[model samples]
Structure formats: C-alpha cells, structure tokens
Target: MIAALLQGCGRGETPVHVSQFDAFGIRIDMQLLGAPEQLATEVAEQTAQDFALTSYSLGLEQPGPMQRVNELLATTEPFAAPPALLPLLEQTRDLSERSGYLFNPAVGMLTDLWRPDPVTGKCSEPPDDESIARLVEAAPTLDDISLNGIELLSDNPAVKLDFGAVIRAYAADIAVANMRARGIRGAMIRIGSDLRLMGDRTGQPWRVPVLRGSGGAVLGTLDLRGDMSVVTVGRFQSPCFRNGKEYSRIIDPRTGYPAQGTQVVTVLNSGDAVTAAAAATALFAAGPQQWGQIARQMGISAALLIDDTGHIHLSPAMERHLQIIDRNAQVSVSPAWQDSGPQ
Candidate 1:
C-alpha cells in the first residue's frame, strides 16, 4: 500500500503538512493547510491509507480483488464484478462517448504492451510494429463490454480494461469528498500534474504555472480560485526512445499509437478530477485542430494547450480565469477560442 503526505505530523501552529509518496506508477504530492494539528496528522495517515486501499481494490500494484476479476473476465467466463468498479465502468462509458471515444479505459492490452518492466522501472525498448498493429486492428472499446446484472463479459477476446487515465482523478474526487466530510479546510493534491486545489491556499487563490514539455519553460501561470482540478498531459511524463526517435506513453486509441500534433494539453475541472484528467489526455489526442469541438462536447470550461510548433492556445474560458503572467509572445489565444470574441 502507498502512504500519503510524507508520514507524520508537522510541528508548530498552522504548520503545513506535506506528504510525498509513489502511487499508480507516479509520485504523488499533497499539502494540507489551515487544519488543526491533530486533524492534520490524522488526515495525512488516512490519505495514505485511502490510496493504498484504492490501489488494492483496483489491482493497480499488487494482486488484489480486481486482478482476480480481470483474470476471469479476460477470458470468455462469466465473472461477478466488484460492485464499486461497475459504476466507474458506466462512468467511463459515458465519458468515452462524450469525448468521441478518445477518453478510453478499455485499452489495457495496449497499455500493457507499453508498460515498463516491473524490476527495471524503465522500458528497455518500444514494442514491435506487429504487436501494435494487432491491437490497433482489434480496436477495443467499452461498447464491447456487457454486463448481465453483476456479471461482466468482454465479447472481444483481445480487449482488456485499464483505468490508467481515470484512476488517480477518481481517487482524488473521493479523497476531496472525504476531506470535506471531515471538515478539512484546504488541500492541494497532485498526482503527476493531475492537480486539484481544495478551498484556498492561505486565503489566497493558488497560483500555478503550466510548464512546457521542452526545457521546462513556463507557458503561463494559472491563478485559480475555488476548488478545481488542473490536469496536464505532456510527453515529458512518460517517453521511450528508440533509434533516436521519441515516443510517448500516451497511446492514441484510434490508431494504437502515440497521440500527435500537441506538445502538452492542460484541462481544468471545477466539478471533478476524473473528467479533468480524461479531458486533458483526450483533447491532446484529439490534436490541436480538433480539441475545440471535443472540449465543447465534454463541457470543458477552460484549458491551455501547447502545440507541436510551440504555439500556445487557450479556450475562451481560460482568458477569464487565468491571467497570462508569462506569455512572452510564445503563447497566444486563438480568436476562435476566445470566450467573447469572434468564433
């Protein structure tokens, strides 16, 4: 089980409690503010446990219930589904349709092909073209999955379910809800740039910088108010190089290949982190040209995207929220995407 906010309590009055731990194959950072010392310590411990419990239930790290469920479901056997996962599946289905099937969760087989070795913590090389071609031809979708009451089955034998895109964000949603229920005041959660801010940061809006995937350039700063999730999908997070060519870990479900035409995509969600995470990846995969329509279909209010040419684009909604503190002529808003400008 992965632990939460660097173990134990922070000393002194209003001492900021911070935790750093690895979960879901990514390092997660969390900070707590404006909590009583006792509550801070308690929340930290509970946060760790929450991640651990979530991973076990979801079969993210170890052999847990979900793994067993997947094993049975991988074949043609009728298997009873975990009650908790069913709702997530339904949610993914709705999101997949809304994002034009770009936010997929049933492409586990393809993800596995790209996943690094468990021992090395790195992939030795990219998968062969033949392997990728086979998965692409199969083209699995959530539609192929059917549920008879609690029994779940996948008609497509080649299909496998992977929630890499949604798991952390969903967990963040649950954790945020749990904190609110506990009367927790303020918190900042980040799991590999799928960031969520709850309440305020010392009574001030959180100022966040969106970084370029290349040379760590600050594309812009987002001054976010209220509770919101900021999810950025970039090639820098996961990449494997072969023969001087770079490949991203984020594979396009449509082609069973890496998503193209964008350097980085950032998505904002005031409602839920799950949608924010999915939308960022989906919008990036939708590419710079098609992101506008997909963003509208997903009801995304604001986002900033860095294209392959280093051009920055912002949704009309972003202009109202983020003060472009670092444009430097490198970043510009698309008139077509400006909230009140000519479409």
Candidate 2:
C-alpha cells in the first residue's frame, strides 16, 4: 500500500510545517499548510503522541489491550472489553458485515498462520494444508464474538483479533479529527500507505501518484480536493514463493489462503480513512471478477484494481479522477456503483 505525495508549490509565503515519525511499524508523514509554526508543531507533536499510544494499545505482538483481549477470547469466556479497544472492534465488525465478510478481523488465526518474519517481511513457507483446513472448518468470524455493553465473549475459541489491516488508517482518522478540532484545516496525514487530506494544499488540490507496484513506476496521479481518504492495499513487498508461484500476504478468510488474481487495489473515500483502507483490502480479496460487487456493497465509488495479468480495471468514478500515465496500458471500466442507502 504505497502512493507518492507530490508537494504543492508555496503560495503567499504561508509557512508549511512538515514532520516525520515512526509509528505502527511504519513511517508516518504529516504536513500542515498555512498554519502558524508554533501551532503546527504543537498539533504534530500531540498527534504523534496519540499515534504512538494507539499503536501500543492495539499492538498484536506486544503486551497490550489487544493482546489481553485475544487471550480472553481464546478461553471462550466472558470478559470485560478494554474501553480503549471496544470502539474499534465495534466499527470493524460493522465493516466486516458491510463487505459481506470480505474484510473480517476475526481471521486473526488465519493471519497468524501466514504472518511474515519481522525482519524479512516474508513468510518462509506457506502454512500446512491441514492447519489451514482445520481453522477454516471452525469458521471463526466476528459473528462468533458477542459484544454487550462493556463485556465480550467468543463462542469459538479459534476466533482471534487482529487489526493490522485497518489500524493505521483508523489512527489517521483520529489524528485528523483531532487536528480539525484544533482549528487546523489544511493538513495531510499519512500512515503507511493510507492518507487523509483536509482542505487544499496551499490552495491547490492534493496530487497523489498511484504506483503500479511497490517501488514501481506510477500508473497515474489523483487530484484530490477537500477532505478525503486514499488507500491502497497489496502485497507490495516480495511475497512468499513455492513451486515458482507467488503468494500474497492479504489472505482470503473463506479459503484460508492468500488472495490471488489481483496485484493491487486502491480506493478513495471522502472523510473516511477506515472504510477506504478496509475497502481496498476487501476489494483485493474479492479479486477481479467480484471486486465491483464488493466495491458497490462497501459504497466505494472510486476504486482501481490491477489484475495479475497487468490489466487495469477502474470504477467509473475512478476513471474521472485518475490521469493515466501509462499510455499503452490496457484499461476497462466498470459501471458506476448504485448506492442503496447512505454509506
């Protein structure tokens, strides 16, 4: 999940404050335009602290609220939900249902099986078929977990909680909200490949380059206006290989295997970072044939998917915003998503 941010030219000599920090296992880049230097620095520092705290609380491997929740879930017993983590769990549960279970966080057991080495960021080998089959048979889902008030319990012990798919984006949304509350309107918050934009960049629309592959050439650029979220999901790093075939890190919960048939999926949502990020992952899992259906279900109008065969598929809304840079690229457009209700 990577997109290049093209900085806008300065106008009227308004100060542009930039800050970079490491959080959630990735680098976070933030920029505030047309704000007083002291205020921008204060907001950036505060947001950085918030990001650090959120990452620590939700960390999967560390001793934190999420880790404690997983422990209690494995016991299949009722326990008090961590106050800080409950809201995120509730939000993702709703997103999972909206995506028709395509963006499930309940597949943590499945994800753990395919977890990459911390240093290499690649799995040495795929999980054994038997192990995958056993978990798939259990069919753990968010539905198996019951949340009532502050209490929670899982009917199936196999259900584990992992928020890696949407945590960065979710945190970015929080940071943005905080910034807005502080009266800072012009800003950009990037957590990993998930980006949140507010207002314009020095009175110019934010220009983002959508890359074809990780460290690969740009496919095109998106000119985003006002507040928006742009997120891309893919196995940007080298995937695990066996028998000369590559395996993606994005797993399909139903099959207990890495999703195939699509190399990358990018989604744009207005003022909703979590949905944008989660929808991209879900669309990737849906692959080429069903991505359109899932995108419509998630209420995502702007999306672009590049299949493994190097064909470009774009939703009608995306085609309008994206300026194609690869002239010879084969492109196909999907019909516009018809929304049934407010998203």
Candidate 3:
C-alpha cells in the first residue's frame, strides 16, 4: 500500500495531527494540517463514525442493508433502494458504462468464485473453467440493474452487487469534503493504496509513494497539489495462488477470471476518488495493450502502467507528475490522450 510521507510540519511548524483507524475493512491514515489538535481529533472521530455507517450499509457479508438488497434482488421485484446505497449505485453504474462495463461491480458471483481464505488470503483450489464460463455466459452487468428515483430492481438474477472496488475511495472523498466543510484547508486521507488530497501541504505539494505493485518496492513518488486522487491497482490486491501461478483479485467481468498482463496501474485525477479508483481497476483489467484507450474513455489523463514484462508506460500527463528513481528502468511515454468523448 502507498503511504503519504507527510513532509514538513503543519503550517508555520504547528505540527500535523495524524490519526490511524480501521474502518471499511482497511486501515485509514488521516493527516490534517492547519487545524487545532482538538478539532482534528474530533474530525477524525466523526470521519471514523461515518466510515462505520458506510460499512454497515454497503457490506455484503454482514447482515445489513446491502445484504437485504441482495436478497430482494433475487426475487426480481421492485423495491425501495436504501437511501444510503441508491446514490452510490447510481454513481457506480454511470462509471461502469463510461468504462464500457470493464469496471463492473455486478459480478459479485464471479468475485465470490475467487474469494480468498480469510486467514491465508489465498484460494487453495482455483475455480474451475466451467464455473467461470457459466457466469460469464449469464453476463450479469450493471446494465441489468435499473433505478428510478429511489426504486430499484434487477432484470437479471445473475447480477449481484459488490462495491468493494470503489467504496474506499468514495469514503475518502466524503471525509475530505467533510474536512473542507469544517474549515480545514489542508489534509490528506490515505485509504489503502489510494490517496485523496485537499489543498496543499504546508504551502508545498503532497508527496505520495507509488509502488511497483501492491507491497512491492517504491517505484517513484508523485507530487500532487489541490484536490486530487492517486489510486493504484495491482496483483497484490486479494491475490490467490494455486501451485505457483498467481491469480489477482481484479476479475475481468467478460471472462469471469482474474485479469492479467499488467502488474500495476496507478491513475491520478483531479476528480472524485471514486472515478479515479474505478478507472484504475478498468485500466488494469484492460491490460497493457488497451489501457490507454480505456483510460481515454474514462476521461483519465494521468496514468502509469507497469506491464508484466516490467516495462514502465506513462501517459504524457503522468510523466510530468511522477519522478522515477531508477535511471536505468525501461520507460516509454505515450502521447497525450485527446478527449474524443466516450465511445
């Protein structure tokens, strides 16, 4: 996971307030600058509580709102979508469409096929090809799910919902907004490998580590300022290994199998973290050959991809932001992605 090495103290050397807490099934590290210690602590507590509520609402394994929604989806009947979940689903569906469904969250059954052992974090046996093919043929997608106002329903029974891919970024966006609302000017939220930055860091840009892969050595650092998101997707995210081959947690919705060909892909966006996170996943699934095209479709300008062969590919925009450390590392800069709009 990437860590924001908070450089320097708070403004005028006031000392930044740092807090660490576990929520949404991951550890969240928050650093707030230009705020009183008491105020920062209160904001952190409130943000943690908000994350708890989001977890309860969106969690599928637990007996909560999302579970109930999934149960109701099985019957193919219209029901009122939970207030907390409706907007998120709407946003995710739009993102899915933008990525040509490459970033689908409706393949919960497909995801469950590759679920890892909680303690071992690995699947002892790889899912058989037949099981994967069945779900792929069923073709469950966010398109099958419909929303009208607060009412929601699914025409396809195979379409199950899982927001694990984007919720952390979504939560971080909310936290950052709440922090800004409270008059705090500078802060950063590091949720897993994804980071959301607000304002500046003691009048300087935020420096965040960019790993080669999940838990892999640091490839370089990205200097970011203002409101932006840096999201990385890699094989170490829920990987399953059987024998010697590794299976990534990022599943190709069309193939119902773990995506391959790309070791890691990180996208930086001056937009909401949710879109940035989804683009990273889609680009990873798109593999090295098609990442640039899919990234263009998703309106992502800055992205870096490390292919399976260890070659580093950078978009023109990304090349400007990242400072590569290894002078001998193979690097190629792609042309700027012109906005042709979504196809």
Which predicted model would earn the best lDDT? Answer: 3
Off by over 4 Å in 1: 1-16, 59-61, 122-126, 327-329, 335-343
Give the per-residue lDDT digits (tens) of candidate 3, residues 1-343: 2233333454568557787888877788888887876777788888888887888888765679988888888788999999999778889988999998889989898898888875666586888999999999998888898888888899999888999888888788888889989988988888888899998887899999988764568888998889999999888776778789998889999788889898888999996999999999999998877888888878888899888888888887888888988676788874334333222
lDDT per residue for candidate 2 within 186-281, as digits (tens), equals 988876666899998777899988868542778899998788999988767446776687788798988999998888898999877989988998
Task: Give the C-alpha miss distance for residue 194 in model 2, angstroms.
Answer: 2.6
Kindly report which residue stretches of model 2 are placed more than 4 angstroms away from their true locations once superposed: 1-11, 119-122, 335-343
TM-score of 1: 0.88
lDDT agreement with native, every candidate:
0.77, 0.83, 0.84
TM-scores, all models, native as reference = 0.88, 0.92, 0.92
Clashing pairs in 3: none
Candidate 3 has what TM-score?
Answer: 0.92
Please estimate how well model 1 matches the true structure, expressed as its whole-model Cα lDDT.
0.77
- How many residue pairs clash in all the candidates, one count each? 5, 0, 0
Indicate the residue-level lDDT of 19 in model 3: 79
lDDT tens digits by residue: candidate 1, 1-343:
4343433334544556777776676787888887766787787678777776677677555777776766776796788899878877898888888998888887888888878776776676777889999987887888988999999998887767778777888888788888888888788888866688898776678888777757366656787767899888888876777678777778888888788788888888887888888898788888877887788778786887888887888887776666665646366666545443332
